[model samples]
Target: MITTKDLQHLFALIAADIAAHRDHLCELDGAIGDGDHGLAMDAGCEASVKAVAALDPAQATPAAAFNTAAKAFLNAVGASSGPLYATAFMRAGAAVKDRPDLSDEEFLRAFAAMAAGIQERGKAEPGEKTMVDAWKPAADAALDAWASGASLLECFDLAERAARQGCEATRDMTAAKGRASRLGERVIGHIDPGAASAAIIIASIAKFVEQHDSCRIDM
Candidate 1:
């Protein structure tokens, strides 16, 4: 089962990955946006990791960790991504409310709930060249893999792959949402910063799950 400790580690991984890719993400945003997406994401994820790290593992539930991270992220980031990710973590926390640990199925549900929450909060749809492009496909791929009896680690692997593909596909799509939308066809041939960062986050989660098999529970 995945414990609160595992969740804390996952946030740390995300923070690290985001920090490393911050400049790349900003470069992508500069192609069609305000070029601050990376800065916001890096700050938010770092804040989340710090907040989650401060929680007492012996007393914190997975839901509590997620909730704490969400608040910290929202408070740290002023960009649109702030509320989007905060809602995602909030929905994930609700998906496993009162749980100290998560079973494989529970984890999948929470993962999918995060994408759903983001979509609801942002009012964005897939193919809009937003983070939803990465998150929705990743959630769907994970759920499908789980339904086919894959282990949690394999499900995460599939999710990460799907997220990567989704991020790459953004290069061919015009931005139908966000600040880039005003750019129209000029947004094409450039990857969306939000989608790219979403891929990084999913990949980090997959990497963490792979390295920590003890966190996995049976299907």
Candidate 2:
């Protein structure tokens, strides 16, 4: 089971991983964006982990932790990614509302909800060269792997692979959304910064599950 403490740790791990890749993320954004994605993401993750860390794990439910993270991330990052990630965390909270702790499957459901929320909030499709390219396929792969009776670790592994593939696919796609869209064919050779960041986030999640998972047995 994943307690509030576990969620806090997960958030911290995510922050650390994102921090490590900050420069690369910014470099990716420089091609077609304002080139501050790395900064915004780092700040938001830091705020989110700090907020989650402040919660009393013994008293806080998973929902409360996720909700707190949502508010903190949104407040810290007023950029376009802010609302998207805020919604994602909010949806994750709602998915497991009132749960004292999360089972592996419950955590997986919350993750899927995050992807759904981002897709809905951004109104972007899979081929739009947005974060949806990574998030959607990753979520789908995780759910599918779980449904197929894979272990939690295996499911996350598949999700990370899917996210990476989706991120790479964006390099061949013309941007259909965001500022990059205005560039048309010029955006085709470059991966979307949002997709790149999304892939990083998914990779972090997969790593977290692999390292701390208690549900390694096949379902």
Report lDDT (CA) for all predictions. Answer: 0.94, 0.93
Please give, for residues 124-178, the per-residue lDDT of candidate 1 as tens digits: 9999999999999999999999999998889999999999999999999998888
List, residue by residue over 1-219, the lDDT tens digit for candidate 2: 878988898999899989999999899889988899999999999999999999999999999999999999999999999999999999999999999999999999999999999999999999999999999999999999999999889999999999999999999999887888898898878888888989999999998898776544443
Instruction: Give me candidate 1's TM-score against the actual structure.
Output: 0.96
Q: In angstroms, what RMSD does candidate 1 have relative to the true structure?
A: 2.0
lDDT of 2 at 4: 92
TM-score of each: 0.96, 0.96
The residue ranges of model 1 lying beyond 4 angstroms of the native Cα positions read 214-219
lDDT of 1: 0.94
Clashes of each: 0, 0
> Model 2, which residues run further than 4 Å from truth?
214-219
